[model samples]
Target chain A: MMRLLKIVLLVCLFFGCDKKAERPSAFLQTQQIKLAPPRVLTTSTIIDSSIVLSADFKMEDVKLRYTFDGTDPTENALSYKNPIQITEAGTYSFKAFHPEWTPSETTTVKIYQKGMDTIAIQLRTKASIKYPGMGAKGLVDHKKASLSFTDAEWIGFDTIAKARIDFGKKVHLEKITMAYLVDTGSWIFPPENVIVYLNKTDSIRVQIPNLKSDTLALADVEIPIEKTVQYLTIHVQNLKELPEWHPGKGLKAWLFMDEWIFN
Target chain B: MSYNRRSFLKQSSLATLGLLSGPFYASAFSSNNNKDVIIGHNSHRYKVDLGWGMLDPSKTPVNDCHEMVQDSKGRIILLTNHIKNNVIVYDKSGKLLETWGTEYPGAHGLTLVKENGTDFLLISDFERNQIIKTTIEGRPVLTMDYPKETGLYTTKNSFRPTETAVSSNGDIYVADGYGEQHIIHYDGKGQLLNVFGGRGEGEEQFLNAHGICFDNRDVHNPSLLITARELNQLKRFTLDGKFIETINVPGALICRPVIHKSEIYFAVLRSKNSSDFDSGFVLIMNEKNEVVSCPGATAPAYQKGELQELYQTVRLFQHPHDVCIDDDENMYVAQWNSGQTYPIKLTRV
Candidate 1:
């Protein structure tokens, strides 16, 4: 019995069972865990004229605060009870707040207002049958596709895609904005270069930059078209081969386009 | 001598108290402590053990840990695409015990079934376009090729099976998820019995039929639960091939359904949105098919009997493919394309 007690005591001491529990450092910042940012439901950033902007967060008693004056949202900002209608263009930001948790990161969405109307559009090259979209009319429909390529709003192409836009008549145009998808995981890449023919003689080219991250996103490429003409032809070159660092290297990359805004 | 004995007893009891109260205090006071990242909601919260199942990469490299299963002996089995070690067996404490198999290059789904008091493993290899059944010791017992009798395919390459489910009577159901989206059923003798579900937008059709499982909770009224991943819904079919109901989990791309006791668990591969790539989480549903908890994501909320859209609130998991629940209610999550990392264990709080 005496030997057993000695063994138990030695085991307890080896395990440091008698050590005093040290308190956490006083220098440690005492703060609540921050909540994740609220979801920005308003996906269409570039609109024709007006849009209904909204955001949602389902946590109980957690309110979504927002500001439309190009400023970060704070506790003093207006609490979002319903969707806000924006007739003018500006930047909108939203943040979720709760009494017990720290405020979430600010989510920003920039809304562009200027959109030139187009009478008709004709496609020279057809999109892939898998991603048929709503046909060529989807380009001028003013409906932007979310970052997801499977939303049917995007017209995907494995080859160079060309589209010809015809305005009602010759009008003053300063620039042409085109929106495309960038999801590297799905092998969808931005166009290599976008060529916009203002007319049969003069044209401008915009080269897409190489992506630095593997994140999925939507990008808008603007081409400077100072000359005004009734007809505009656009040639979007698909990335012929994926980068060497990509898993699907040496394979043809896909090109997804959602909308084209003529300004 | 009597006083010394009493004093020794007192010291020993105090040491025991200190050791027992340490973990209890750490968890009880975790709300105010930022050291532990507790996830999930309601009565299903858990803390992640990232270091669990981590092995020496130089010895046993993994490409994508696709699925996991716990055997009757309480041993955890993981299936990865890496041919060097396709299946790695580990203890509940994440100690590597054994490794085997080099032929399952596209190892995706793993299901364990007990028959005649012997445990068998069903491995779905999409790359090889077949379902291979083997003993627990890595010996092949049977091999099921493409369902040629279904007349749904013109070539073997078109029948990429992703998941499988076994009925109580040994009937096998294969979900050709990456193929033409059909569920092929066969008897225990490997004879094709029936086939249903094709790619369409109808109620009985499935888009990306990624996973399938037998729902034997109600023994008399067992059904099959299949996942239409792209549509973000779980479709239930009667024993034969009749559509019952669709459980909508909006904004969550669930990979598979793992039923444990009275609840169903799923590894949400990613959020339904296009922007967030690594927004994956684990979802739990009660017996009534209502989402009760979502770990690494937002709390489950419903309005007017319809579940609101669910998204990732915390970036904990990246493309989690499967979930394995042990007898102790702990969960092991296997991921796909997540930097080739090992399975992460979530200990119940």
Candidate 2:
């Protein structure tokens, strides 16, 4: 009887002790957990004079804070009460925080300066019917598409995308910047090469770099033209065939263009 | 000798105290003291048990644990695309009961049906382009191929069915989600009766008809809830395939609808868009189709009767494809493209 009682006691003792410690709940582990980043909503990241930047988070009692000096936002940062008016070209980061919750990841938005205005634009190639975007004017509409191609801001092309832009008057520009999406998973690739003609004479060819990752990324192809011009004609060569490393190797690659900035 | 006996009694009492003081025993008996992570919002919060369904990968490997269902015997059944062990059966406590099926390579959907007395399972295999009805013990009973009589399908490949819903009268409704986006209706005898909802932008059509379920909440007015995943909308249709209304859940790529009691739950496959990979959560709605809670994501909010765009607020889930609720009001979430992991169990808090 004593032996049996001892065995029961041992078993009870075995079941009593917890191998794991009584750690704090993960939800309560503020130092180790970070909330998802807040969304930075704006008409366009590519701005001319000024742009309205709005930060939003779904959770209540959460304050959205931001910084424009390329630093992570903290509780002491400027709390976002309304949409911020950005008049300069720089990087802006936003973070969401609550007293009872961990701070959110930082959301970064890059602003590019483009002051030249296009009075008229013409599409020389047909855009894909599925992603026609806002038409020819969308390229110069000062509106930029997100990294997502389905946002309907990007105009896709299976064939070569050619366009001509008229500034209406001569404007000195340092360079021409064109932005495109490179989402290999969606079969969207950067153009093979972009040829730009200034005033139908001075020309330069910008070759896109070969991407090594399959992640979604944006490419800004810049053509250096340090002269004044009124009319700009450009031809963006589509990737004729997907690279051998891609799953759709031998198939045609799609070219997605969202905005063109003349600076 | 009297002193020794008294000392013995004292030791026994101390042992008992020690047992009661154990943190493990305390937590096991009183859930109030459980230190597990608690998530969700409103009256639908849950305690996450991330290791509830975890198993030895070498023994019972799973890839893309697609869907799950609870049997009449209170057993949880999980379906995966991994052909090695396509079906895994587990008890309510997450104990391994059995594993079966090596033929369903693309087993994407699992539905449990109780007929007369016995429980049966409906498995939708998109890669095989067929739907197989099997016994709970893994015996194949009925096999259905593409609805060739519908004339909408050019070939068998064009009938990639993703989900199936059975009415009380034994009628089967198949959602050809990845195919031509049509809903094929058939009688109990496997004969095609009617077809509706093809690929279109109209209210009667679907972009990605990923899931379907019989909503008998209104007994006299039974309807079907279908998922238009790409559009982030849950469409309701009458029994005969007439558009009733739409419940919009914008920004969530919902997989299927699982109705339990007075609430509807969905495994949001991804958030924002399909390309935003590894962003998923579990969404729950009340009887009025209002989102009450979203575990692993933002709290549900409404502006002018329209649900605000929802996204993941935490990385708790990655591509949650289906949710199965048991009799205990607990949830089991199966995932797709999540590193060959097992289902996650969420116990009601």
Cα error, candidate 2, residue B132 (Å): 0.3
lDDT score, candidate 2, position A245: 71
User: Which residue pairs of candidate 2 clash?
Assistant: none
**In model 2, what is the error at residue B174, expressed in angstroms?**
1.4
List where candidate 2 sits over 4 angstroms from the true fold: A1-33, A74-76, A98-103, A118-138, A146-153, A159-171, A192-207, A217-219, A223-237, A240-245, B1-36, B273-275
- Between which residue pairs do clashes occur in model 1? none
Per-residue lDDT of candidate 2, residues A20-79 (tens digit): 534334222222234567878776787777899998776666788999988999889998
Over A54-164, each residue of candidate 1 has an lDDT whose tens digit, in order, gives 887766668899998988898899999998888877778998876544566677776776577655899999899989898898887877888667888898899999998
Cα lDDT of all candidates, in order?
A: 0.79, 0.80
Kindly list the per-residue Cα lDDT of model 1 for residues B1-349, writing each as its tens digit: 0101001111122221122322322322233433455778998988776657777788987878899999989999999999999999999998999999999998998999899989999999989999999999999899999988788788889998889999999999999988889999998767899999999768888888999999999999999999999899999999798999999999999998999998999999877752445568899999998999999788998999999889876445667899999999999999876666788789898
What is the DockQ score of candidate 2, to 2 decimals? Answer: 0.09
- How many angstroms is residue A92 displaced in model 1 relative to the true structure, after the best TM-score fit? 3.4
